[model samples]
Target: MKVIVVFGVFFFFSIAAVMAQPANRQVFWRDLQSRYEADSNRVVRVYLDKFGYFYPVNAIPIDKQLFLFPAREHNVNASTISSANLYAYFHANQTAQNALLNYYQVSQTGNFDRDYKKVEEQELRQISRQVHRLVENLQAKNIIFLVHGFNVTDPVSRYVFFEHSVSQKGYDTKIKPLYIEVYWDGLTSVSGTDLLAIWKHAQNNTRWVSLALRDLMRHLDDRLPFTIVTHSLGASVATGALFNTSSKWLADGNTHDVDSIASSIPAPVDVPIKLGMIVPAIPGGLTFVDFNHRSPDITTVANNIVGIAIGYNPKDYATSKAFFSTSFGATTLGCDHENELRNVSLALRGCGYSLAQVQQMIYPVQFTTPNIALGLQDHDFQKYMEDDVDFSLFLAKLFNE
Candidate 1:
């Protein structure tokens, strides 16, 4: 009887120990990097710094999951000193150049011995070369820019959402225009700050975001037309930059139509822009508001774009509360009633635009309940695009036209 009892105890202990062992699952970051690498694609990460110049952000080999933004200083690590932000870096590695950097052995294994300044310099040259090559190719007539919203950590989600939207519209990478996904620090935790702080933080983030977009537009080939697909806060980023009259970003004598805006934007002369805002989390009718009577009205911004589309769902309760309520104390365009736009003339006039011309340039899209399937209450990228026939058809016509 004693021996049998002892055997039973021993069996249980062994089983518990076996269960405690960690599983050998593949790291998600590694898998994401490998997927792009397999296709011979190189990622070029563009990050705008406080100085207003966009810099190249890189990932260390020790863990490519974290990307270190280099600054102007050097500190020795692993027998090597370099200037970079080692402590403050993103854990997700969404930057596109992961594979190529690995191939070049940009960093030493388990040793931060490489000169980051040199690495950054080399990476910048590589990115410029890649852009020049693409411009010379002349195969793609247009480029798609993907902008994500706030409070996101997973890098793969952004890529998947981007690819899905582009693919759904019958645009294949092999035969269609090239695409670039802009990943910024959109992650915000509500536990730490009040609503005012959060709003200010978003303003700071978009400050650089606007500069990055302006820089990107300048970099692209002048003849190629480009379209933007932005979700949530991305709408704010686009509208702020396009309509902002006093931003120092445009203070470098690039003004066109000076009287229209005290600081008029240098509208793209060679390339056209088509803007799309999906589940945008901005205040209702904020885009159409006239900012300081002297400034070129939001309609002026609308005039610059070839087309604009706003996607909203009445059932998107998340935006209704988190975005609309918090920002304006009421439902926003993202959560407004379907017939909100029924009075087209009234809506167009509000933004200070003529219905005859701006009617087709800007429009709103309403999504049904069945199409909203991305979050707890459905307020994400997937909900806005997936299986939504109307949205897809809209894109087809915009791009086709």
Candidate 2:
């Protein structure tokens, strides 16, 4: 039996490798990066300051080892310390940043490592300050942040492109909200067999990011409305920010399943937030009920949000086996949580939620049916994005349309 299990894992990963994204997909990601570079001033990107992402984030996508933002920076667009890009005309920041520094004649130290480290820190700080300023002075009162899930590569490019695509649909004209693409350190899997490890890694990253996100929220104007649209394990990160106020993870260096939130948020997410979870990788039991007295202070997932838009697939393959909990029906909220959602009102009552609030969680079956060409059992998020009907319904619910 052990031998069979080992062979099965290997076969699964082999298939996953075979199904890796095509070459054309790289073109699309690069195109978005180039476009964002050309008009970066117009956008706001907030990413976790953990490890570097799988691919380069800032510079034009090439194998030249050039990076726009150097290693260990907060932004996802950075190369590792050892793989630092050369400082030259062809490298990142050459045309714009290097030219400006040259104009000022900023003196550089003879030591290359010392000079580069100083420059990297300065660039990272400037990026952080710019994002805070934009958040403080947002033209739109309603903000929509897009967060992706585990094993997603080049998310910065993909989500920035997604923001542009959403705008092209007249969403920007109608909602007129500031769109921020959030990139977290959701570790990518080395192979399909590595899914479990990365999933756990992503969850840990979620906790760290949650605290940072809450801090970011504190900087924003509290009067404005905010919403988040998340897919897959991004659901955990979203919930942690809204409800898990405990910073024990910071002090103790280990995760505490803290979900109970205080009534007052201290100028941080005091208002109700609209959450859109598409194919989320959360446990159904936790979604509707606070089992095991995990949050004895009271308040569960049902209490944290004013409105929710849940996108599910009854035949979803990813969430079904994301953690090898299929037989136990443990966490496949994307597929096996309809009954749990129906019972969510019971949980909301303890939170003192209004009838209207209870009624706002929506999922229409018609919007969730998978297409034939797209694998019926697969959990590819692009399937949801490609289907106009499902995507529109999701957006409508997210913005309370």
lDDT of 2 by residue, 31-118 (tens): 3445556455566665442212112245423332223233334543212221222232122344544443443343455443344334
lDDT of each: 0.47, 0.50
Task: Indicate the residue-level lDDT of 161 in model 2.
Answer: 58
Q: Write the per-residue lDDT of candidate 1 for residues 1-401, one digit (tens) a residue.
A: 11111233232233231112111111113333334543324223344321122333333343432332222214322211111122122112324334434544565332222233234345445555665566456456666667766654445576566666766557665435656656554534445344333433343345445544554554454346767777877665565544453322233232222222223334343467787877666554434442322233333453556677778766675566633444432225566643444433354466566676567776677764443343425766766566467567557645766
Q: What is the lDDT, from 0 to 100, of the residue 42 in candidate 1?
A: 26
CA lDDT, candidate 2, residue 322: 36
Clashing pairs in 1: 43-96, 43-97, 73-83, 75-81, 76-81
Q: How far out, in Å, is residue 66 in model 1?
A: 12
Off by over 4 Å in 2: 1-39, 49-138, 221-223, 245-267, 285-304, 322-330, 354-356, 361-376
What are the root-mean-square deviations of the candidates from the true structure over C-alphas? Answer: 16.2, 11.3
Which candidate leads the pack in lDDT? 2
Model 1: ten consecutive residues of lowest lDDT: 18-27
